[model samples]
Target: MIQSDTIHGIYGTEAAAPPKSQPMHLSMLPCDLKRHWGRCGITANFLATSTEIPSPAAASIISTVINEILENSVKYSAIDTKPIDVELSIRNNTVECEVKNWARLEDATIIDSYFKIIHDKDIEDLYFLQLEKTATDSNNASQIGLLGVMHDYPVTLGCRIQTTADPITPFQISVKAKIYLNEVTP
Candidate 1:
């Protein structure tokens, strides 16, 4: 079982508790991540308008991050009634994008394994390995999404799985990707 402490660490120190002044601002985009909804193309459109990320490269990175997470959410989600949640916010000069969705109980373990790659491996090695796999016609193409975000973009990635109150989907998967504004080209 994935521990709460591990999840907390993935979200960074600030996310451990809410700020005393104001809550973390979350703006939900119009796009539905549960369905393909036109792949990255459509998601990028909404993501572009969601925040003034300033850097064009940063905007592209944010869009790609969202696209990858949304794809995973839709592919893994067990319940369609529960809408996939996408939140974009700016905190302490960093742009944070979070995507939440429900996954089957049995499939929840995948989150832990994915994060293992994040904590254990070097991003560059993983990226090249994934590229090599793709070149070899490997069936596990979906695994590269997170790796691409970590290797190609200047962002930090995190994920966690928790039990929700909903009986239909008692487990929820939340993935977060954060990029510093200063890292992006203005």
Candidate 2:
């Protein structure tokens, strides 16, 4: 488990410090969620015991969301020998998970379409409908896992895909998500 104090110290020395008034959390990328569930379980227990929050649901949601985000990074973004970067933080009753990869942007159209479809209607209904469509459609290659996250979790989810220009590599993609806990329920 990464502590808030350590995160504060690391970001403090940088040129521009991140906002520090909010509660935050952090974790390093694990080998795999199955292999590290034990660690997550312990972390959840500690957080539940230490915080004023009564429910352990937030911790469970964080673990699952991070696992899915990391899995996506490993499967989609780790293409050119670049290590996946995962960061978790909380601010103003919200939890943010960000994953960065050193891969060129691919199929931006498909990603845009996915977002469009997801945004057009209620997330829960859209997610279930998409799952059914994916199961029935033979031509669909897009992963349904993301929709699953939206369906299973009540938190408002946002995704951003960013591109950067580097002299040598030319491009890199960053995927970020912020899950608000205040609206999520156990």
Candidate 3:
């Protein structure tokens, strides 16, 4: 599970000095997005071995993040129509996870608008605001996934949109999340 190796360079052990420089990658699909939750387990295990998420507590946090992202992917993707892509990798002490799925054009636009707010102010501030709203009205829990990642973990969230060639339903969205492996708060 821990896929790492030591490689020496002419500079003498420089290339093999630190584990942070060697990143592991894992790509899995939610074969049946509507019924499958294994993708989240796969992601959590991969993160546990590939990154510094060794503690049970740390693993649980990463699992929560992965679960939310994969859930969003499954929720937006056409049921049983396409495989939800989950990619996890680590590089320079930073762990990156990306969830990609095809979504209705209008849904993609709305998701994009939400991601856009992350850039306007401190995400922690926005997260707390959302938390307050959720406390007052349960419906506000709808947007807790990404905001929970920002507030509870040291992660930055981003989104990328690619319109498909098909004019009818043309949006494929990729949501990217990054967390520093050694910087986990708890």
Candidate 4:
């Protein structure tokens, strides 16, 4: 069983989203991840309009980050029936996005390791390394969504993998990315 302690961790420096942040929570089936991909942008736009410092540019960044996370969630999800839960918290200049879904034990472990490697290694080096790997390997497609967002944006990412004793649904993976809202007027 994956230990409760080992399975949970914050990838970047910040451990939690802002305490007084306003939030928007959403849930949808795994199949809807692609079908409703536009939700990412919708969510982002909501962020832009909701904040005092509204910026369409910030919305774009937030949208990209949200898509990557939702894409990853769909890729690793274990059950079709379970809903993918997403939460967005906006506090001042910070917007935090979290996506959660149930996954098979193996995928859960893989994502957990992915987060650890990002924390341990230089992200740029790993990004280049992953690019090379993706170019050469057909079977082992490198998961680049998470990596690309981390590389391209000024965002902090985190992951939590939980293992349950229940046989029906044994693992759950949650990923969060915190984006610093763009200050430029849009």
Top TM-score: which candidate number?
A: 4
Cα deviation at 148, candidate 4, in Å, is: 1.0
Comparing 2 with 4 on TM-score, the higher-scoring candidate is: 4
Candidates sorted by TM-score, descending order? 4, 1, 3, 2
Model 2 ranges with Cα > 4 A deviation: 1-54, 78-80, 107-109, 137-142, 166-170
**For candidate 2, what is the TM-score?**
0.61
Candidate 3 stretches greater than 4 Å from native: 1-31, 37-54, 138-141
Q: Write the per-residue lDDT of candidate 3 for residues 1-186, one digit (tens) a residue.
A: 101211111112123333444544444444554556675666666665655664666666667777777777766674346566777665565666777887666777667667667667687789788777878885823777777887778676777767776565466777777765677655
The candidate that wins on lDDT is: 4
lDDT digits (tens) for residues 1-186 of candidate 2:
211111111122323335334433544344443356465445434433443342577767766666565555555543434455655555656555666554443533344456557656777788777677878888545476566777777544444444445444333434455556776687
Write model 4 residue lDDT over 60-156, tens digit each, in one string: 7777788788778877888878888988777656777889888887887788788788888999999999888888889564678788998888787
Question: Of models 2 and 3, which has the larger lDDT?
Answer: 3
lDDT (0 to 1) per candidate: 0.68, 0.52, 0.64, 0.75
The candidate with the higher lDDT, 3 or 4, is 4
- Name the lDDT value of residue 113 in candidate 3: 67
lDDT computed for candidate 2 = 0.52
Which of the predicted structures, 1 or 2, would earn the higher TM-score when compared with the native? 1
Per-residue lDDT of candidate 1, residues 69-153 (tens digit): 7777777777666667777666665677688877766667777677886678787888898788887885864578878877877
Model 3: which ten-residue window has the lowest total lDDT? 1-10
